[model samples]
Target: MTRPDPADLHPWIAGYLTPYTGRTRQNATQYLRRWETWCGQRGTSIEDATRTDIEAWRAHLSARGVRARGIGAALSPVRGLYLWAAQSYLITHDPAHLVRMPRRPTRSQRPWLDRHQLRRLLDYVDHAGDPAMRAAVHLWSLCGLRPAEPRQLLISDLGTYEGRMSIGLSYRKAGGADRLTVSPPVEAAIRAAVAGRGRGPVLYNENTGTALSKAIARLRLIRILDAARVPHVTPYGLRAGFITLSLEAGVPERDVMYAAGHSSSAQTAYYDRMRHTIRARAVHELTDWLDLTGTPGVTPMSDVPATLPP
Candidate 1:
């Protein structure tokens, strides 16, 4: 049987999701559809779903072995739709307004690589055969670009303002042009990666000559970590580490938030922890580490095969 158009059942859905991307639109539609089906089974319409009805749906998801995170993801669209409808005067109240989703685990609760592990990973990437892969690591670790952000980056995105180098993100997480001040290493890596090309992706597959997909980029990072003997971490975890390190180094909270593409300082603060000792102590203090380049167990770039493997 054909599924009825969600917008047909509720015309507001179309306009509500119109601003979102195709993938997001599809996911939101699916989530709303699930809610619609559940409402019908419960002898109610989405417009009439009470707070109790939403709670029951949550309970239903829990009974089906859906974890808290999964349940929250599925319910997000439902809440969004109701909230939008209420604001638009299509509904008298938002049943999902007071209803709460399960709390996500705190940043400190999740596993992330430490400074030593990150240095090791970078060293491994530097010695890897792919220049694009090495550049990707630098962008993530140094500039804190999201996995997809660097993939969409073009040569034109490289910029300088007030004599400081920066990378302009066209597809920022917040849906606007976000320019991040690049560190020396980040600037060098990006400049070298796009040296010959006037325009195109900063990282691309040599064989395909196309931008690397998120999955492929993630696989490359995993391989680098394995080679470096670092514990497995998600791409997001690398971003978390960047925020954590920057804050620990006494970088202003606003600067860290902007660099990490976080919408709020609170989002950046989640990664801050008292137990994680500062890596760049000299950055916060006047004293300098005698040899910051010499990470334990990793040789200097001069000793490693820095060039792309033949």
Candidate 2:
């Protein structure tokens, strides 16, 4: 039998999810559909699903060996729907509010590659002749970009600010434009990857001529790590190392946060153990090791502004 239309059951879901953007909106849509399916299978309507009903569903999922993270992922959207409905005055009482997620198991801190290991990865990509791969390595391994950050970039995002190449980015989470002044190697690699395309993802597959996927990128990185005898690390590990190493090297906490795309100091503070990590130099001090090939943060050309220092 086909599932019933969710709009027929409740008309508020669309309005409730309207504020979410990108992958967040997609995931919410999927989770709500699953909730609707579960309600239909149990002969209950979403409008009438009580806290008890949600608890029962959680119990059922747990019985089937679903992990806490998986269960939480399924429940959050449903809970959000109820909260929205109540706030909008569409529902007099909110259900699913009291249903708590099962506690997740704690995992150890993620490991990261040192500068030497990262250099090896960079060297590997340099010889690979895939401009997209080269740009990806530079952004993530050197610039400390989260995996999603570079994946969402468009070719148009790369441009010159004050005679130096820079990337203009709008954060998906924070929703602000963060323009990063790049070093010579970063500028060169990004331009080569863009390859005169007016628009498209920054990380593209030359072989397939499509946007490079995060999974494929991770798989490629893992292969390099294995060959180089480096420990496996997630994209977050690369970011962690960037933050940790920069802080240890005495790059000011403020500059470190700015470079890492962190909106607040609290976010940057979580990466290191020290309360204070300021030193004599600015951001360029930390990035100078990259061999910027010009005075750090100095404009090669005249007549433009630096949005944020390198």
Candidate 2 C-alpha error for residue 275, in Å: 9.2
Worst 10 residues of 1 by lDDT: 284-293
For each candidate, the alpha-carbon lDDT, in order, equals 0.77, 0.76
Best by lDDT: 1
Clashes of each: 0, 0
- Per-model TM-score on C-alpha atoms: 0.77, 0.73
* Tens digits of lDDT, candidate 2, 62-93: 99999787898888888889999899997899
What does candidate 1's lDDT look like per residue over 122-188, in tens digits? 7777677777877888887777777677778877888897777787876665566777777776777
True lDDT of residue 189, candidate 1: 75
